[model samples]
Target: MASTPAPTSRRRTGATRERQSTHEGFLVHKSGRWIKISAALAAALILLYIFVPLPPHHFGSSWLGYTLGTVGALLILWLTALGMRKRAITPGRWSLKAWTSAHVWLGVLLIVIGTLHSGFAFGWNVHTLAWALMMIVIVSGIFGVTAYATLPRALSANRYDAEGAITEKQMVEALRSLDRQLHDAAQPLDRECAILVDHSLEQDPFTGSIINRLTGRYPGDATREAASELRRLRAHRPRVADDPLDKVDALLTRKEAMLARLRRHLRIKGWLQAWLYVHVPMTFALIAALSAHIVSVFFYW
Candidate 1:
C-alpha cells in the first residue's frame, strides 16, 4: 500500500507554484536566473581562455576565437531584437520581463566574449572601433539601470506634499494659478515693486536648456530674482496691514516653491530619459561598425 502525501506538503508545493508564477522586476526575474547563467558562462569562458593551451600569437585565428566571435555576433543580433519585442505585449515563459532579463545579462556577457575573441590584440581599426562602441553601449546601459532603480523613488517623494501626491500637469497648473494671483496682488504696488512682480509673471515656466534640466540650476530664473528683490525692498519699508506688496511677495514666494518642485520633476525625468539618447544611436553605430569588422575579418583580413 502506498502512503498519501501530507496536506502540509501539498500546501507547500502549491505555495511554491504561486510564488514562481508571481512576476518580479526584470533584474531579479526568476530569482536572478539570467544573472546566474551569465556569470557562470562568463566564468567558463575565462577559464577556457586561461587554461586551454594555444599560442598567444595565433589565438585570434584559433578555433576558440572563431567560436567566440560567432557567438558574440549572434548575441548582438538577438540583443537588438529586444527593441522589436517591446512592441508586443504578452505573458508567460518568454514574457517581456524574461526577454529584458536575458537582454541585460547576455548584453553583459558580450564583454567577455568580445574581449576573448580579440585575444587582447587592439589597434586603430574597425575591429577596435566596434569593440569600443560596444563598451560605450554597455556603460550607458549601466547608467540607465541605475537611473531606473533610483529616480522613481525621488520622483515620488518630490511629488508628495501636505495635501497629497501631485502630477506634472498639476505642478504646472499650480505655477500658473500663483502667477495669476501675483498679477492681481501687484495692482496697487509702486512701479519698482510692480516691475519685480512682472519679471516673474512674464517669464516662461519651461524656458531652459538641456544643461539647465540636467543640473536643475537656472541662474537667470526671474522668479528667484523677483522674490529676492521684493524681500530686500520690503526690509527697508515700514510694515503695514494688508499691503499689496506684502501679498505680491507672498505670491512670489509660493511661485518660487512651486518652480523648485517642478524643476526637480523635470530634472529627474531628464535623467531617466537621457541615457536612451546615447544608448540607442550608439547601438546602431556599433552594428554598422561590427558589420565592417566582420567583412574585413572574413574577406579582407
Candidate 2:
C-alpha cells in the first residue's frame, strides 16, 4: 500500500494554497494596514502641495490638475462602460459603491486641482462654460449619489414585506383570497364589491409622468372610468347592514393596504429610475462641452 500523507502536512499544504489563491482587491492594498499607509501618503502629499511653494508657473505648472482631470475623465468613462455592461449592477467594491466613493472623493480633489489649473483665472469664454458645465455635472452627480445612497435604505426600511414583494399574480391572488373571505362576510346587499377590489389592483404602473407621481395625481381616463364603474355599481345595490359585513370591511382594509404598499413600492422605484433620465444625458453633454473647452484653450490660446 502507498504511504498516506500526515494530517498536519495536508493541513499545512491546504492553508498555503488557500492563501495563495485569494486575490487582493483593486490597488492591491488588501488589508487595513495598507489603508492606513495609503491614507498617510495621501495626507502627506496634500500637505506638501499646500505648504511647499513651488517654482514659477511653467509648461507643467498645472500638472497635478491635468492628472486629476484625466483621472476624473477616466472615471466617467469607466462609469459609462459600467452602464454598457448588461450584467446585474451590484453595490460595493469594483461596483457602484466603489465608483461612487471614487466619484465623491475625487470630486472633492477636483476643487483643488481645477482651481490650481486655472491659476484662479476666470473669463467669459468657452472655457468658462466648460467649467460651469463641470460644476453642473458634479452637482448632478452629487444629487444622483444622494438620491441612490439613501433611497434604497429608505425603500427597504419603509416597505412592508409581510407579503414579501407582491407582483401582479400576487395582487390577483390577494384579491381572490379577499373574494373568498367576502363570500361569508359580504352581505347579498353589498354592491359590486369584487369589481371595486379588481379596479384597485388593476391600476397601471405607467399612468403618468414624474410630476404626476410627485403630486399623487394618478387621476386619468382609466382612473375616471374605473371610478365611474364603481359608482354605477354601488348605486344599484344598496349598502348592506350586517355584522358579517365587519369581516368584509376588514378584508377590504387588508387588500387596500397591500395595494397601497405595492403602488408605493413601484412609485419609489420609479423615482429612482427617473433620476438617470437627467443624470446620464447631461454627462454626455458635459463631456462634449469639456472637450470643446480643452481644444479651444490649447489651440486658441
Best by TM-score: 1
RMSD of 1: 3.7
Each candidate's root-mean-square deviation in Å?
A: 3.7, 7.9
- In model 2, how large is the Cα lDDT of residue 89? 62
Residue 246 displacement (Å), model 1: 1.5
TM-scores, all candidates, are 0.92, 0.56
- Candidate 2 structure quality by residue, lDDT tens digits, 133-227: 66666676667667676777656754546555545456557656655665545444245564554454455544667776644456553334534
Model 2 lDDT, residue 2, Cα: 79
* CA lDDT, every model vs. true structure: 0.91, 0.57
Give the C-alpha lDDT of model 1: 0.91
Could you tell me the lDDT of residue 167 within candidate 2? 57
Q: What tens digits encode model 1's per-residue C-alpha lDDT throughout 86-168?
A: 99979888999899999999999999999999999999989899999999998899899889989999999999999999999
Instruction: For model 2, state the Cα shift of residue 86 in Å.
Output: 7.6
lDDT score, candidate 2: 0.57
